[model samples]
Target: MSMWSFILLLISVQCVFGTSSDADETLSVMEDDSVTLHADVSAIKREDQILWRFGPENSRIAEIYKQNMPTYDINERFVDRLEMSIQTGSLTIKNIGIQHSGLYKVTIISNGGTSEKRFRVIVCARLPIPNITRDSSQCSSSSYCSLLCSVVNVSAVTLSWYKGNSLLSSISVSDLSISLSLPLEVEYQENNIYSCVINNPITNQTTHLNITQLCQPCADTTRCGSAEAVIRLVVSVVVGVATVAVLVDHFRSVSDTSPLVP
Candidate 1:
C-alpha cells in the first residue's frame, strides 16, 4: 500500500474504534425508588461488563455484573436493599433513605473501551407533626379569631386546611409558618374541628385544633367561678399536706433525740 493510503486507513480504523467506545450511558431514578443504569452497548461486539458504584466520588462498589453473572459487594447499610440485573444493565435500589442520597456511577467495560455515567440521588426527611392553634379572641364571633398552622424544621412547605378529612383550602409558602383565616360564613359549631396538613414531596404531617364557641354569659361567669374554686381547693390541699409533712418530720426528729437518752 502507498504511504498516504496506509496513513488514511490507520486514521479510519482509529475513528471507528473511538466511535464504538463512546456508548451512550445514562442513569435515572425510577418512580419505585429504584436507580436505573442503562447504556447502549450495541457498538461494542465483545463481552461487555457492567459495574455500579455509589457515593460522592464513586469510591464504593455497590455491585458488579460481568459476562451475565452477578457479584455484589455492597456496604452493610445496603446489603439487602441494593440489587442489579446484568441482562439489561439496570440497578434497583429499594427503600431509599436519607443515607442513600448521593451520586451513583455506572461503568461499562468492553474490548472497545470503557465508558461511565453519573446520576444524583436525593432523599427527603420525614415530615414533622403540624401544630394548629387559635391565635386570639376568646369568642368564636370575634373577627380576630385566626387559626395558625406551623410546621417546624420543615422545608418546601405545602400547607393545607381540612375539615373532617375534606380539603377546604391549600396554600404553598416558602417558609414553615402558614396562617389561615377562619371563614366567617362557617357556623360556629362547624369550626370546632379544624385540621392542618403540612407536606412536602417526600413526607407529610398533620395536626388538629378544637375551637369551642364560648357562650359569653355562661362561660365568663360560670367558668371563672369554677376555676377560682378549684384553684382555692388545690392550694388548701397543698398547704395542708405541707403542714402535715412538717409536723411529722418535727415529731420524728424529736423522737430520735429522745431515744438517744436510752
Candidate 2:
C-alpha cells in the first residue's frame, strides 16, 4: 500500500474509535417527570443532521435534517412521549418512567465531520413519606422510647432518622423496590426534636415525630381498653341474672294468691 493510503487508513480507524469516547452525562429524574437531554450546541447549523437513539439497541427515536422539521419514531414505547428542539437539537422525554431509564445518544452529522453526545438516565420512583411509629416491644422500657422510621415500596433511597439536625440512624436500598426501616431510641423526657426522612437522588419526604403522642407507655391505652371491656361484660351478666330472678318470683307470687277452685 502507498504511504499516503496507510496514513489515511490510520486516520479512519482513529475517527471510528474517537466517536466511542464521548463522555456520558449522568442524569436522574423522578418518575412521571420530564427530562431533557441537551445537545450542548448553542444552535443548530443549517447543514447539520441530528439523530437521537435510545437503549442498548440504539434504536433511532428522533431525527432532524438541516432546517427541516424534526421527526420522531412511532414506536409504542416512545409514542407521544418524545420531543426535540428545533433550535438546539435537544431531546426531551415527557412523563418518563422506569422503562425509559437507560442510555441515550445524539449524533450530529455535518460538513465538519460527525460528533456525538451520550446520556445515562435514571428515573427514580417518587419517595414515600417516612413513617415514625413507636415500637410496641420497646414501650416496656420506662426511660427510653424505641421508635422506627420506615418506608415501603421504595428503591434507590435512604431512610434516615434525625435529631435536631443531626443524623441518628439511616438505612438504604439500591435496586429492589422494597421496604426499609431505621430504628432510633430516645429518652422519654427528651425535649429535642426528631424527624424521619426518606430520600432518593431526585427528591425527599420527611415526617416529624410527635414524642408526646407516640412515645407514651403502651400500658396507658392497651390496658385501659382491656379493663373497660371486662367491666362492660360483668355489668351485662349481672343485670341479666337479676332480671331473670325477679320474673320467677313474680310468677310464684301470682300462683300462690290464686283461688283454690277445683
Q: Please state every model's RMSD to the true fold in angstroms.
A: 16.9, 11.5
In model 1, the number of clashes is 0
Name the runs in model 2 displaced over 4 angstroms.
Answer: 1-22, 220-262
Each model's lDDT:
0.57, 0.80
Q: What lDDT, from 0 to 1, does candidate 1 have? A: 0.57
User: In candidate 2, how many Å is residue 127 off?
Assistant: 0.2
**Structure candidate 2, residue pairs in collision:** none
Q: How accurate is candidate 2 locally (lDDT)?
A: 0.80
Write one digit per residue (lDDT tens) for candidate 2, span 59-131: 9999999878999988898999999999999999999876786679999998889999898776666777888
Q: Candidate 1, which segments miss by more than 4 Å at Cα?
A: 1-46, 63-65, 128-146, 152-156, 160-187, 190-195, 202-218, 221-262
**What's model 1's lDDT at 96?**
64
- Candidate 2 has its poorest 10 consecutive residues by lDDT at 11-20
C-alpha displacement of 105 in model 1, angstroms? Answer: 1.0
